[model samples]
Target: MTAPVFLVDAAALAAATVGGVVRLDGDEGQHAATVHRLTAGESITLTDGEGRGVHGEVVEVGKGWLDVRVHELVLEPEPALQLVLVQALAKGGRDEQAVEAAVELGVDTVIAWQADRSISRWRGDKAERGVRKWTNVVTSAMKQSRRLRRPTVEFAGSTTDLATRLRTVDAVLLLHEEAEVGIGAARFPQAGTVGVVVGPEGGISPEEVAALAHVGAQPVRLGPHVLRSSTAGPVGLTVLASRTRWTT
Candidate 1:
């Protein structure tokens, strides 16, 4: 079985080497010991969450910390073409679900898009809490998915926000049911970030779609069937993956 993974301080992992000590303490340590019940001599993996990680075996277990001796370590390289999901915040926790699944599916960044039709609103302190919630959700999902680097979280206020953001991206795809082209039709940028815009359940407004498209974002459909806002981003990401890294 794959060893259980935990996140640790980057500085600590940087100072560690083969046969050296790596520490896990505090809530993480509590989770490793009291929650997961990992004992001395059990193997575990640790990542610093910036693509640097280690595989080691536990040597000592304490009330609030666990020490592991490093065996193997790896530093994952960033992808040439990063996938960004611009998911509109949805009600009933669907937006949260979308972020969780997208990170697991290898999305490099997730931007919370506040579309015109979205019922969910992130305002005042709720915006701060909502972003924090998305960050926490992605962090947990990374551990669960065994991903070394956690996916990023971002927020967009509206179609105007999205349009301005789209300016910096090399390519942007607006997921619209009314689109004539399928996802496969578009040719991605040679070496830059790709953005996929997912609309709310009420669907993307024609104005919103046009606004994005006006800024050079392509409107494309996943398939004949319309997917939920939560599912569409992941599916779109998977399709891009297949045509790129997972092509063969």
Candidate 2:
């Protein structure tokens, strides 16, 4: 069976190492200790969220925290392929679901785009709040998935903003239902970073699709059946990860 994983801040870990008792203090801590029902001398893995992990055994238990002794430290190499998901804002909880799944699937980054047809809109403070909420969701998912690295989330102003972000990566893939080209046929650059753009429920407008294509973003079709915005990002990430041998 896979070991249970928890995310520990650098300070909490330091305390855990010196025979110092540490409490799981926040909601996350409570979840780890109470929900998981971990006990003294039991082993659990802790991740620093920056490609660092430690195997630790619980030494002391508190109402909220667990005192643990670090047994082994493991450093994982960064993924060979860096995948960024530029997801168009979807209604209700769908966007949050997408972010959560993307993180679990090992997406390196997420970009929230206010697509022209999106029903949910984010502006000013709302945009910042939305980003924070998605960030928290990704963090939680990362911990649950036992990932060593946390995915970064960014908010985009316009398609122009997305285009600018695409420049930082090696290649950008635009997933459009109307696109004729299959993802498997497209030749992804060797040892390259990839960014994938997924549209909203209403889908990407032809003008926006053209705009992305103009910026050298290759359009790829997943399949005949259309997928929900929440589902597309994870599916695309998984396919991309496998195609590039990012994860074994």
Candidate 3:
């Protein structure tokens, strides 16, 4: 089995490699030592969460610390094409679950979309809390999924704001059940990010679709069956990923 991976700083990993010792302290250390019950001589992997990784074995285990002997340090290059999921905020915390799984499925970035049909609203202090909550979710998912590259979670503001940002993306696909074109027909770029938009439970408003379409966002269908807001993004991303370098 592949060793369990923990996130560390790139510079710290670099310095530790020279010394041949990578230290794990703080909450992370406590978790590894106490919660995971990790013992000395067990193998573990450390990642910078930016594609850099180190494979090592625990040399010493303390009450709240661990020293690992570095064997190899590698830096993985970014994918030729990145996938970003634009998810509409939904109730019952399903949006977080979607992004969490999307990160596992190789989504490079996640943008929270506040659509007209969105049930949950983020404003004032609540906005900051929401971001933090999602950040925690994605972070945990990164480890759970054994992903080297940590996926980002950012609020996209209002739908109009998100629509305006579509101009900068290589391709924007809005998953609409009513659309005639399927995801297989999406016009992907040679390079850059492919943004996939998933609407809330109530679905995307026609006016909102028109607004996004005016800004080069294509309304595409997932399939004959309509999926939940949480399920749509991951399913759409799988199609997008398969069509791109993710399969290659």
- TM-score each candidate: 0.97, 0.90, 0.96
Residue lDDT tens for model 3, 1-248: 87887887677776866339988877778888889888988988888788888889999999988988898877778987888899999999899889988988888888888888898999888888888888888888888887788888889779888987777888899899989899998888857888999999999998999999998888899889999887999999888878776655
Q: Would you list the C-alpha lDDT of every candidate in the order shown?
A: 0.89, 0.81, 0.86
Clashing pairs in 3: none
lDDT of 2 by residue, 32-151 (tens): 778888888788787767877777778877777776677777776787778889999999889889889888888888899998998999998999999998888988888788888888
User: Sorted by lDDT, highest first, which candidate order results?
Assistant: 1, 3, 2
lDDT of 1 at 226: 90
Number of residue pairs clashing in candidate 3, backbone atoms closer than 3 angstroms, sequence gap of 3 or more or interchain:
0
Best by lDDT: 1
Rate residue 36 of model 3 by lDDT: 85
Question: Candidate 1, residues 168-190: lDDT per residue as tens digits?
Answer: 88899888887899999976874
> Of the pair 1 and 2, which is ahead by lDDT?
1
The candidate that achieves the highest TM-score relative to the unseen native structure: 1
Error of 3 at 188 (Å): 0.6
Q: Give each prediction's root-mean-square deviation over alpha carbons.
A: 1.1, 2.4, 1.4
